[model samples]
Structure formats: C-alpha cells, structure tokens
Target: MGYKAQFHPGTSDPSKNRKKYMDPAYKLQKIRSVSDEDVVRVLGHRQPGEDYKSVHPPLEEMGEPECPIRELVEPTPGAKAGDRIRYVQFTDSVYFAPISPYQRSWMYSYRYRGMDSGTLSGRHVVEARERDVEAIAKELIESETFDAARTGIRGRTVHGHALRLDENGIMFDAMQRYVFDKSTGEVKYVKDMVGEPVPAPISVGKPLSENELKTRTTIYRADGITIKQDAEVLQMVQNVHWERSFGGFEPFKEAKF
Candidate 1:
C-alpha cells in the first residue's frame, strides 16, 4: 500500500491551524473580497490590464535546451511564457497573527511550486514568475491567513512586527503604506508595497476583532495554548532533536543523550 501523507501532529488550535496552512489539499477559506485590479494596485508591479512584460521569447518559440530533465519537468504558465520574476512580501504580527514568517514559508512550500520563499524574524517573501506571483499574492491577501490590520504587504522597509499596534489596532509601518479609515473602520492602501504612491486609495476591508485574531492565531503564547499542553507534539519535537543529534555520531550506536 502507498503511504499516506500527514501534515502535522497536534491537538491544540494553533497546531491544527498549522496543519491546515501546510496542507495542499485544504482550500483556504476566503474571508475577504479584493478585486484583481486592487491587488495589482497594491503590488505596483504593472498597470491594470497591461500586458505581462516578458524577459525572453516563449519557451515554445525559443525551443528549450534538449535535456531529459527539461522534458520530464513541466513548467509553470508564467515560466512557459517567459514572464519576468516578481516578488510579494508579508509581515505578520507577533500578537496573535494568523500566520508567522516561518509558518508562511511552510505553507508556501506545501501550496506552491516553481517559486522561492524566504523567512525572517518579522517578514516572509515569495518570489516567482510575475503572473504566478500575482495570483498567489491575491489569494493570500484575500484568504483567512490575512488579517487587515495584522498582516502587512511590504516590499521594503519591513517594520512593526514587534512594536505595539497603533491606537486603531493596526500594525505600525514607518513608510505608512497602509492607513486606517476612521469613518469606514477599514484599512486602505494609499501607497504601494515599496512606499510609492498609488493612483487612489484601495480598501482591503475591515480589521478582525482582537478576539477573532486570538482564535485564528497560530502563535503559541502564555495567554494562549502552548506546546507543553500537547504531549504528542512535544514528544515529536524531542524525538526529531534526539535523532538529529544521534545521526551526528555513528548510525549503529545507541543514543546516549
């Protein structure tokens, strides 16, 4: 029998959320509605309805190098069309953000291909062929993984992952790419990801309540559930650590530590 895949092992909400985020088969819940035009607007990659700029001739026209590996591997749409590489970045809050930087990398690994991702203490970046990147960014921004106030779309000058949220309960951004609307109580992007001015404001929607953020957050804290609460998770972590340490020595020898 073929082996079935297991995403992660845990009983806690955060653990379950992690599994859900890292499962490719799981269709992330769409919690907000942002049009493709608006998504493009915030990214500032290309003008709306503009033809996708290409780096080279299409793979079919150019005739790729004759290699077995090339024949076996299917290229993504953007790659086939020779689209330029583009990037999108997100900064997640430490205080009950739905997903953190490390988890975002894991989620991207499971859910995407033909892309490169990097993680930092405060932010995560995904780079891929332009069209594919735009699609991925749009989905991520509108999905439940994103919270209007907690999740930031920043291409440069990533800040506010550790600082206290503003009075409106939104993460702080030195560039002021996004701002809170007092009347509508929604978050709007007046500037592009790199702090460039957009033609007009684009509303991302209202922020989630603090209670909602806690319930959806994947981060473990003293106030919320912790790893100590799940013995299976703790044991799995310890087992992996022990095995890695043991592997450092002879394979046949028993683990002493």
Candidate 2:
C-alpha cells in the first residue's frame, strides 16, 4: 500500500504528542514536527520521496505546510474521512496513527532511479538492541525456513529460527575487512569498507497458486553494499535496494509486514 502522510498540529508542544501518527520514519528517524494549523493551510502536495513531485518548499524553509497530510491512503478502521493521520498497511490491513509527515524524496531518488519507478515499498523495524547476525542465522535455521547448509552470507551462516512458509523474508549483509591488533586483541574496521553480499544461486521456483507465491517467496542478501534481491515464488532473484533496506519502508513496533 502507498504511504499516506498525516499532519498533527499543536502550539504547546508537538513533540509531547508525536505518537498519534503511523509514519514512524518521520518520528523515529527524521524527528520532524508539524503544527495543526499548517496541515489545514498548505496546498495538497505529495510528500517528498513519492514518485510525484511536490511544489511546496522544503521542511526547513517552510517550517510546515497547510494540510498536514502529504501521501494518501484509504481510511482505516476507526478512522474518519477527515482524520489527520498516517497509515501503515501490509497485505489487506491498514493501521492508522497521528504523526509528523516529513519528505523522503532524497531517499526515494537514490533507491528507485528509473523514471517509471515511483512509490516506495517495503518496511523496517526498529529493534531494541542490535541484532547479532549469528543469532539471527541460528533462529532461521531452527525455524527451518532456509537450509542451514545452503545459507551463508560471506561465509557467515545464518542459524536462527527458520522462516515460516507463509511469511516473507528480508536479508541484509554487511561484508567488512578488519585489522586485528595482536597486542590488544581488538579489531578495527572502517565503515567505508563494508559492502553487500553476492546474490544467492538457488531460487524459489513458481508455486501452484497465488497463495504459495506470497507465502514462499522471500528477499535475500546479495552483492553491493546497499542492494539486496527479491525472490518471487516463480522468478529468479534480482538486484534491488541499491540505496535502501529490505521492504523499502521502516517498521514501527514489532508487527510483521
């Protein structure tokens, strides 16, 4: 589903009540603020980063727009037509919340380069702690979604809970070179040297039904620092996300996409 931006306005303090919006990127990552009056005044413009262009001034310059909503989505449960909200959707369900809507044009430009490519896809989750790759691999292995023997990104194998047949998967890999200091037993690594993994050789073949396609297909780590691959139920995996993470969107809360 497309991202729908919602504007929330306030005078006392916008930060105190930022949780109302569903678009977490603006809140968690961007930390932008919009007032209610701005939402009611600005002309309707696509939020920055959508395939369409916006004529509005940058957030820094304009402070905030008239109407808070930027992107659009269908009204969600318990939501009214005039509700100021951001909507998060996956499959057939939509969730609504109030949040500051910020432009993501720069990110979209880098991720979807083709003129025909518009709209963002995918979502990410913010974890409480950094996930250990080795632990994640162990979980995948235990779950039995991927064969432990066949799975290895840059010689580092995933051995975690396996993914379920009905669930979609996203993979990210960071390949790095390290210099081990013999005296201190410490490894120093440069952030610039990290890169993406090579594409996987095996592909998930076409399933018998649409349900199978959605259930069996998964995204896997591939070469390049930013690019990963998506494997459909019937098609071979291809390069994707040269500039973004899996699912194209960031996750709010722990809910699965």
Candidate 3:
C-alpha cells in the first residue's frame, strides 16, 4: 500500500515513478556538463546573496572577506584638545557633559546616571563648588547697601566718586570702579569695569537735588539697607550713603526705625 502508484486522470503518480523525477542523471541534466563554449558569461559579478557562482571570475578567485566595522576620524587641524564639549544621549534629552581629565568616558555610577545621565563628570562633582560661588554672589548682590561716607555729596565730591580722596576717606573711582572702603580697600568691581560697554557710576558730575536725592533713595526694610542711587538710570554716580534719610517717603509697611 505504501508503494502503490495512483493516477488521477491526468497526473502521474510520483511515488511509483520517483526515480524518473528524482534521478540526478535526467532531472539536473541542464547543469550536468560545463564547457568553455557552453559556459554562460556573467557581465557583472554576483554579490554575497546570489545563488550561482559565475565562471569568468570564478568563486575561487574572489577577494578576502570585508570587515563590517568602520574607523573613527581624528579631530580637525586646529580643534581644541579636551572632550569638554561632547554630548551624550540617554533616555530623552541630549545632555552636554564635560569629559574630565581623569576619565576618558562618561562616569558609570548608577547615582551619576540617575541624576543627569550622559554627563561625563557627574552633576555632583561639576556642581560641588557652585553653591559656594552662588552664596558669595548673593552676598555681593546684597552688598549694594548704601555707604554712609557718601552722604550729602555734591558733584564729583562723594567718596565713592573720588579719584583720590582729599581726606584719605573711603571712595570709589568713577573711572576705575575701585572702592576704597575701610574693610576692603582698593576693591575693584572687576565685572562692572570689564563688562561690555562698562558700567558707569550713576551720579558723578551731576549733583542730586534735595528732592532728587529724597526721591532717588529708596529703603528696603527687608534688607535693612537703603539704595542711595538709582543704579538703573545714572552713571558715574557720586552720591551714595548708608545713613537713613531723617524724614523721607516710607514705602515698606514693615519698616522699623
């Protein structure tokens, strides 16, 4: 039964005539013999995925296996050395992480990755000294407190505006931005002097009138300090002081005498 060959009307039974179809001598006769004359000429070489190997440049003459990887390019002619500007990709945002001298790649610590991934030197190390810097910066910003030595000052006469104090009193050179205060003598506000277009003193040559001075000076009770000169409008300001004006317009409700 297993060997019985059956014919359905037009079809020959494959089981009974298995040799007729399966024999290599007759079935694969098309590729049985190859000769220089019968050989098909392949115009171009077939690549890796092709089936039949060409005759002209036979499979035996094929070149070596190619590498799948590529090489990295070096920096440009004048490119800066450090990898400080390298960007790293993490979950979402592309973070700019500074590559430190010690480590060539991004830090591998999980804590570092969790904080701000892809930062070469983690946020903690990079930002370690920042708080101290910010604290000092805040102190400087608040130190805009008035200087008592500058009160009742006329044009170019206030200590803060003097080029060379006549009485050796504290002063700030309108030209140099240097403050000769008792605590910190010859203190140069370098930022103000070096910043673009350089900040100028608010009231150096122009004398503040009684009403102008009264209106110009505003006391901030929260800070317990008075702003003598309007840093916004004036340049080369000669008038500045710490002494509270006796009877001026009071703005703050929590102001204490």
Candidate 4:
C-alpha cells in the first residue's frame, strides 16, 4: 500500500492511548457488564419493553426518494426503523481520565455511524437513534475508558470535571447522581443522567487503580505524560498551525509540510 492510515502521532504513552482510542479497529477492553434493561432504566427515556415512539414513519413504509446517493448508501438500523433521536452525555474528570470530550468525539466518529456529537468544557454528548444510543452508552460505561469514580454520565448540570475529588475519591455531582459505596467500594448510580431518580440504583463496577489510569489515560499532564515530551506530536501541531497561517496570508505561495 502506498500510504497506510495513521490515527494519531506521538511516542508518549498518552499519545499512544489517543491513537488506540481513535482507531475503530481497536476493540476497547471491557471492564464490566451492565444489562441492556439496566441501561434503559439509567437513561430514563423510555421504560424497558416500551414501544419506540418515532417522529417519522419507518423507511420501509414511506420509502426514500429516488436519489443515486441514497440508493448507494445504507441507513443505520435505527434510521431504517424510524427510532427517535436520543442522547447520552459523559463528563470526564481532568485527573487523567482515559478519554475526554474531544477524544470521545474522535473515537465516536471513527467507530460509529448515523450519530452526532457535541463537545463542551466538561461533557461530551452523543445523539443517535434511541436504541443505538443505549447500546453505545452501555459499551462506554462498561469499558476501560470509564472509571466508575472519574467518568460521569450526566445529561444536565455538568459542572464538576475541574473540581478536586472528594474524600471518597469520586468526582462531585451537583445532583448527587452516584454515590461511592463505602462497604462494597463500588460506585452506584442512584439517579438517571438527567438527575431523575431511578427505580433502583445500578452499579457501574469499581474504579480503576491509579496506575491503570496513568497508563490508559489520553491526557497530557506535567504530573503524568506531558505534551512537551512528545516532540513528534508537538512538531506536527506547529507544522499544521504554520501551514494554516501561511495559507491564509499567502494564498499564491505553495504550502510546505
């Protein structure tokens, strides 16, 4: 092959983690299991076994327009079934959480289809068909990317990513959606993402060890893996910035890599 695809650049461990997460080919290691029904309950959108309410008819019923692009492309199962759009939002602590909002968007774009993502200061929200969102949420919750104490599933009032952790070692939640069980040493969610009470609390399993977080995290920090250490990544960023500046000012000049 002339040119193989490269996901991200850097020799640092965090940089390597960034590449692994963004590559669709890499299967995220599963850390725990939460039932599909439990995921539905945690979302608090529709109860388990409830029929999916739709804004438009299924594609099979109404049929798509006679466009060549539409003919060539296949719709997601949710789109074909006319499932309503739903969202799942996650808040990542700045204390070396495995993945952050920007990384989540990159990973999601690489791994999924028929979805839209919004990244903010503290949260990353992915919106897709209801069932599809549920599936994605479940996988993310049970994966190594999510530390029960660090990654929060918050649909609203997301305001604690930058704050210091509590004595219990869990990130602060304004709504107190989850609590660290002192006895079991597990993080359990008592409320839904939107701060609504769930019928029963769901356990997302134990938090990862500090060493594990340091190894798997994509964040570049002075205390951990700093960006300055990754010379390749830093140079690439500078090159891209320089190229953009030169292109904006000297449109006629041939750009250099």
Best by TM-score: 4
Q: Pick the candidate with the highest lDDT.
A: 1
Give one digit per residue, the lDDT tens place, for model 2 in 4-121.
Answer: 6443222112222321222345322221222322211111122223332233333445444445353343222212212122211111000111110121222222222121111222
Arranged by TM-score, best first: 4, 1, 2, 3
Scanning candidate 4 in windows of ten residues, the lowest lDDT window is 248-257
Tens-digit lDDT track for model 3 on 1-257? 48633211111121112222222232211211212111111101112233432223422244424534312333221121111111111110011111111121122221121122223221111121222222222221122112222321111211232133335333333333323344433222322212222232222122223233232222212222222223321221221221244234454543342
Q: Backbone clashes in each candidate structure, one number apiece? A: 0, 43, 18, 0
Model 4, 176-221: lDDT tens digits are 9999998999999999989999988899988888898999999998
Q: RMSD of model 3, in Å?
A: 38.9
TM per candidate = 0.93, 0.16, 0.15, 0.94
- Clashing pairs for model 1 are none
Using alpha carbons, what is the TM-score of model 2? 0.16
